[model samples]
Target: MSDSLKVGLPIKYALSYRHKPTADIFFPDSTYNFAPFELVSREYFPTVTNPKGSLDSAIYTLISFEVLSVQELSLPVFVRDNLDCTRVFAPIDYVRLQGTISASGEMDTMSLKKDTQVIPLSQQPNYPLIFLFIIGLSFLGVLTFWFFGTPIKRQIKLFRFKRRYDEYLRLFQRLSRATDDKKKGLENVEKAVILWKKYVERLENKPFTTFTTKEILDNLQDNRLSDALREIDATVYGGIYSKTTASSLNILQELAESLYRKHRQVLVQST
Candidate 1:
């Protein structure tokens, strides 16, 4: 038996039997039990009759799977008689097991303690980027208000002014047609004057509704405004509705359009 026996590696062993020339000898086959050691291969040799006796030998290739430090095995041969078979056993042989991996001689000096104080760090939120994003949004709002706020307000005011002016022109036209009837001439002229006063008051942000015609001429200092209001007053108080009065009413409408254009120009320049 070999002193160094590695698990799963094949071990070679020879089995021999010396019997009489006429005797029959046979080695154990697959029916025999070889526990812990598995038979891999077998080699047979021819019988040699050397006058001493007939020698029969065979080699077995075996492997052991057991982890025991020492492994023992024994094999047997059979002798055949006329009516029976006899078993002849060999002496028990042992082999020492060898490990596949070699260990370091200084294994006792190695440390095995664990580091229990190592704490996993939790992921944190990115506050700096969030704060900067908020600041950027606020700054964008301020810039939008700063750059386009006045223009947007001016556009809205201009739209409202145009709507009011359009309504005034329509009502004034209807009233002027009413002035064609002699019975309603004074009433329509008075209403037209009130409408004009109210519109101009809103347009100029002034108290034109409270102002006398003379006070209006003083503030406006326009000769066309003076002539237009005088004509309208004569129609209201004296019941006059002539071609000249019609022409003067048209002049009032033109004057109002001119004031609207001037106000629009001022609004545009402010923006």
Candidate 2:
């Protein structure tokens, strides 16, 4: 036994015995408890046999973390029998513990000084995690645009179509109501005609704005359109406002509504 052992340091202990038994014996494995100390390693020598007896020996490496001044330990070996195993214990051993301490001896309590100052540490941002989150968000955005871009565009176009059509209807109807006034009626007619041309051009993606009434009839190839434009043109050119002017405006409005529905259906089906 050592006079004193430092904490966490390893020490070796050995045991040996001789017996005439025929059965084999096994030294302590990891399952064995070395209470006051912890096991580090184990080394065993083969049995030596003579006619008199068989000798077996084993060494255990151990360490202790306990603060107890005196620690005791004992190891055991198992002897196999026909039915079960029996444990044979070695004699007890003792070791002394030595704690770490400064050689300066005790301090004078009255002379001791203390500083109470504290420095605060600034919090740091998790830049890597922030960057990863931004990248993930950007990737998700790109994926959404890639998968749904066409549908989004179709929806925007449909919305614009409806909005523009509504605006045209509101303006044309307002001007049509004002056509009863002979003072502004002729001017209103010209404005209404221009408005219709622009609306139809946008709706059908045609050049109706530049087209003359004859050109419009030639392109549309519809007798109703020809008749309606003839009435509207009579009021526009001859400076006349009659019941036919109002009917012609209604006819133009119906044509525009029909064109709007046709184009809207095409967009819906594509979506």
Best by lDDT: 2
lDDT of each: 0.84, 0.86
**RMSD score of candidate 2 (Å):** 15.1
* Total colliding residue pairs, candidate 1: 0
Best of the candidates, TM-score:
2
> What tens digits encode model 2's per-residue C-alpha lDDT throughout 206-270?
89999988888877655688888988888989887789898898888888898889989999889
Range of the 10 consecutive residues with the lowest summed lDDT in candidate 2: 99-108
Give TM per candidate. Answer: 0.45, 0.51
RMSD (Å) of each candidate, 1 decimal: 28.4, 15.1
Model 1 Cα lDDT, one tens digit per residue, 1-271:
4666898899987888999999977897766788878989889999999889999999988898999988888899999999999989988888889988667565653676767897889999899999999999999989998998998888988898789899999999898778777677778878887887788787788999999988888767567777778887887787776667777777777878888999888878885
> Which window of 10 residues has the lowest lDDT sum in candidate 1?
101-110
lDDT of 1: 0.84
Candidate 2 Cα misplacement greater than 4 A, ranges = 1-130
